[model samples]
Target: MSNTGSASFLRELNPNRVEATKREALLENPGFGRVFTDHMVTIRYSEGRGWYDAKVVAHGPFSFDPATLVLHYAQEIFEGMKAYRLPDGGAALFRPDANARRFRNSAERLAMPALPEPLFVDSVRELVRVDREWIPRTDGSALYLRPFMIATEAVLGMKPSPDYLYCVVATPVGSYFKGGASAVTLWVSENFTRAAPGGTGDAKCGGNYAASLAAQAEAIREGCDQVVFLDAVERRWVEELGGMNVFFVFADGSIQTPPLTGTILPGITRASLITLARDLGLTVREEPYAIDQWQADAQRGKLVEAFACGTAAVVTPIGKVKGRTHEFTIGDGNLGLVTARLKSALLDIQNGRAPDHYGWLDRLF
Candidate 1:
């Protein structure tokens, strides 16, 4: 992974921009990821040239050959994060450097050239700086940033591509939990496996998400909000939800989550929760949690809360776990105290309402 800090070069595009009047109309009810900002960042890469052609340009589509490797082989990866508008009229990115590092890790895992860390940060900052006006000021809202890389090589071979393209896009988003942070229902999948022992679960790749859509559709059809996947090998140990990591809160004030067992995404929110829990003087553990344990604990009043964490939801309470033969309801089927406290603490830090004792926020504009 390249540790370079910032890009040495940047170019501005023509000022023929689209006005935000129509966008503002959408922002009033900007239900997640529906409306996009006017600008985007892009950089190109080849074996000999490395990463080049860094620029901020108008938001538009790109032409790709029919034989593009990504279209055929699915050689792509991406990262999701947010930029918050502080009350002081400035913008901040939460743990952006960590995202950069994880982006590089995802690139390396996919056999793609890693963009220099400096270039990555520079692209994000430049885009957010230009589109700072799009950062939503309402509570529980943010400017969602998506950075992605795709193999652009027009070849038919099964080998890795030598050419790639990296781009960043932003969207104004509202709270993921539309009504409120109420408890959610989950569907347990016994017929599908999200990842294997040596699979790309450790990387945030498009294919991983694409593979989960069928299971997710099944969950929704069964009247559940999300699908919980188990380990691919044994299909017993708990893994994660479709797009988020899982957490379990005990009645004794302790917390636990499934470990990074090479079949789970290492979420930034997951890591932050561990730190926050430790700071709150709660004992936290990372281990292999079984689905049966959750059901048994809820039955015995030992497991008080269950939630999922990611960039989109931040933190969401899990009220019920529904499987083929059993259904379990946790802690009166409502949000628990530990879950509420952790969510508020993380939000406060991101929104500049609390002290950033860990320096997790980076001022971009």
Candidate 2:
């Protein structure tokens, strides 16, 4: 799938044949990534034919050859974002354009065909419109959208596949953390590093997450909720968690997050919070923070709070840090004021409870 050009057409719509009725039950307790909607969008790409055969079909299984290149080489990438059910009984997407750009970046990094930005957003829009009812009405709940592309060419000898498939699937989710917006514990992993210099750390791909699983399992064993990784070179500077970006709040009323040095995921939610924090009269800084500094600051009461941000988790407070050598609690081991305020501000904008001062919400209805 080498053709990297813009193409447009009407997608063939094939709605779900069955009428959905378990929505209330699912919405009541739709845990993260468990309950999916009834329809999905798909688009195909070939070396000769740019991008074609777009369709909105019923959610079902797909058949593929055992020798498919994606099965072996893992030439695939994905993006995670959400469609929020607004206060006015409508639907909106939060910074989907940013997700579309990141999707293209991931595609370029993985040697896959680049789906046009318009095409990408349009595909998601169509899917969400068809399954708008799947958007959970519960506060702090949304329809999680996953857009991905995979290498489909059967003849594979460690080369880019000539055929590609791009798809979008959505699921109604409540909270990524177990106990709703409660604080969480983190396990600092000194043994495993998520990405190295000149690696695929910045790209949103499957392999990065797969590589973090071992460390994540270790965190679970340590009775922690998530794992934090340090830089791969010196192994001192704090990088990020398995799937979320980290932030720190000082007792002097200031904020700092690790700068994006082509080694961090550059989370959309992270960027949004930076703006929102500034609007709320808080100083936000993007800088490299060391693990030892975090521990020292917390111990001395200089660092009052810490948190992680991502599309799935949104804004989650980091209450405690359990490292192999050291362990400490941030503030009172509870959700801090800055963390709660930032979460509420972002959620208010997303759920239409507050004005979208930055024009981040893209209303679909």
The per-candidate count of clashes, in order, stands at 2, 1
Clashing pairs in 1: 5-118, 6-118
TM-score of each: 0.97, 0.96
lDDT of 2 by residue, 195-294 (tens): 9978999999999999999999999999999999999999999999999999999999999999999889989999999999998899999999999999
Residue-level lDDT of model 1, residues 1-365, one tens digit each, is: 22344564365653865566766676677889878888899888889767777788887899999999999999999999999988898989999888989999999999998887778878898889888878887788899999999999998989899999999999999877666687889999999989998899989999999999999999999999999999998888889999999999999999999999778999999999999999999999999988888899999999999999999999999999998966999998888999999999999999999999999999886
Candidate 2: give the clashing pairs. 1-162
Error of 2 at 100 (Å): 0.5
What's model 2's TM-score?
Answer: 0.96
